[model samples]
Target: MGIAGVLEDARPAAAMVVVEFIFSALQIFIKLALDDGMDVRVLVAYRLMFGAAFLCPVAFLIERKKRPPLTVKVVTGLFLCGLFGITINQNLIVLAIKLTNSTTIVTALSNLTPQSTFIVAILSRMETLKLKKPSGRAKLTGTLVGLGGAMLLTFYKGPEMKFLRNLGHTGLSHAQGSHQQLRPPPAEGSRILGSFLAITSCFSYAIWLTIQAKVGQVYPCHYSIAAMVCLFGAVQSTLLALCLHRDTDHWRLGLNIRLYSSAYAGIVASGSAFPLMSWCLRKKGPLYVAMFGPLIIVFVAVMSSIVLDENLHIGIVLGAVLIVAGLYMVLWGKAREEDEQEADEPKAKAVGQDEELGKETTAVNGES
Candidate 1:
């Protein structure tokens, strides 16, 4: 490969790193909007709608000529992907952050997404346990460790991280006197509930990841599919938002954090981020993309510490270690499995070639 080829190969890796930063910023933005007292439902609705508006035109221009027809089955699948993937996933995420009052929790839990996806793949018969193989064993161990980390994060917060807490209070001085102070941070029960919501949100995303393959198979137009999902999710989220909150004032976005966060979430996070991810997925495969998962957690932890002045706990420290360790183990196993398969291919081909040559010689001898 020449310079161009090398650059092209490196592009996805760089893009994924940027994507993780975008995602980390997204959580902070959403949390900021929530702190500003914008209703979560309203924010989600606006976000999906904004994403749709940004993406629909691009999809139409790029894929309109070559895109597949939107048949009933395809539309239905897209709708469900929107419902479970975008609508449910986005809403639950916002709610979880609101309850936890910490972006770190959400980002930490997100590491579970890959594990959930792996489990879903195995149960759906797309993959084997391969428990007998070292690669498989690594993957299994990784999943268990990751789950243990999540459980630890949820159940035990450990001692208060006083230094970090002090940093948060200092960082948040300007953000004080908002509705945030009026409503006390979540108690134990609320924290547990928030953790549950975050876990459920991760599963919802995993389900989307798995089913998107079927949608992609039929549509084959990634841009168009994303546009449709955003459009559908917008509609679903708006209806739900209206049902939950009747105040028109809450829907209005002034020159404030609420508007800024919504715009960023919709335009940058949903609109731009999705396409970049699609590009990376096509270029580098899911494993390569997944290997970057740990980056999001790191980004979020740092951002939260600096931006939200959020404190870290012993549980968070310990849980992050386990989850990140698990993610690498799983990715490593997958890499090895792929490498072994690739190595076997040439050997198998050589064996077949030798058999063919021997058969040709035998035929010639018989003729003589």
Candidate 2:
């Protein structure tokens, strides 16, 4: 209606677009870094460490006044959040991307988060459903469609689409320290392992989302929660890196793309994106926020093709289309439900007001 109103409405859309693009770039950067022989665990460890370093100060500066006492319950939730959200989620995704060499596949499958979150909510009794209702049916249908799309992306590798052939391999490739050269794909075993990892990461992310919702309710300070999670994740990942990548060589960082990629992933992807998503979840609910998940797929698909020399297959194109469609369907259903609820509120309030007026009239007539 007004400038303020329009800007307010556009904020979430803008945030989604910005975050997704940052993530797309992060994926490409991380892949390039890994291709340069950066250890996965070390990369993730640095990412969380830098993320915490950035987030902790901001949380203290901004949410310091609003920060509540950390109870055992909140601390425990943050620990689990870090474990699932950062440790498992990041590890699986990195492995997936390494093996598959397709950020498109990774992100496309991530669109399953809404469906997984919905199921997790139901199981945890956080959400109730009436399958007989239009809203319920719509949600179920959307979930199925989204899952189907994910499956297609995971298993089916159709021929590359001809329309996009003209784009060429514009991305700088890394092969044995050679920059701007085309790199070959990994073995079939690696691909299979990466696909499995990606699928598992999706479910892990859904569980993280569910737990994040619960934690957000008890502790409304989004920045603080994100900071704490990053801290815990940093600790966990560092330990794992120490144990698994025991080489002192693995810990060393050079003035190379590895440093740049880790910095971007930490500052932009984790530091900024997590807090924004948490706030959005608090304001708009998880489904509303999750609907924007498809943007990452689109961004990654284009960026991966250009930056990583990743190809787009027919299955990927088809799966992305289905996932986007399902995203809109679920969002539409949620909007309809909200509209119906809002409509009923006015009618209920009017009835109460009319009843009160009638009672006042009766009292006046008796007094007269």
Name the best candidate (by lDDT).
1
Give the lowest summed-lDDT range of ten residues in model 1. 171-180
Tell me how candidate 1 scores on lDDT. 0.87
Candidate 1 lDDT, tens digit per residue, 1-368? 89999998789989999999999999989988898889989999999988999999999999989997779999999999999899999999899999988899878988888777778889889989988887899889999998899889998899766664555555553466354457676798888889889988888998898788888987899999999998999999999999988888989988988999999999999888888998888887888888898898888887787677677888988988898888888888889889878998999999999999999999999999
Residue 6 displacement in candidate 1 (angstroms): 7.1
TM-score of each: 0.88, 0.85
Give the C-alpha miss distance for residue 316 in model 2, angstroms: 1.0
Model 2 segments more than 4 A misplaced:
1-12, 162-165, 171-183, 275-288, 339-368
Query: lDDT, candidate 2, residue 185?
Result: 69
lDDT of 2 at 229: 92
Collision pairs in model 1: 168-309
What lDDT tens digits, residue by residue, belong to model 2 across residues 99-216? 8877788777777666777677788888778587687778778888877887777777799875553454443532332443456766767776787788788778888878887898
Q: How far is each candidate from the true structure, as Cα RMSD in Å?
A: 3.3, 4.4
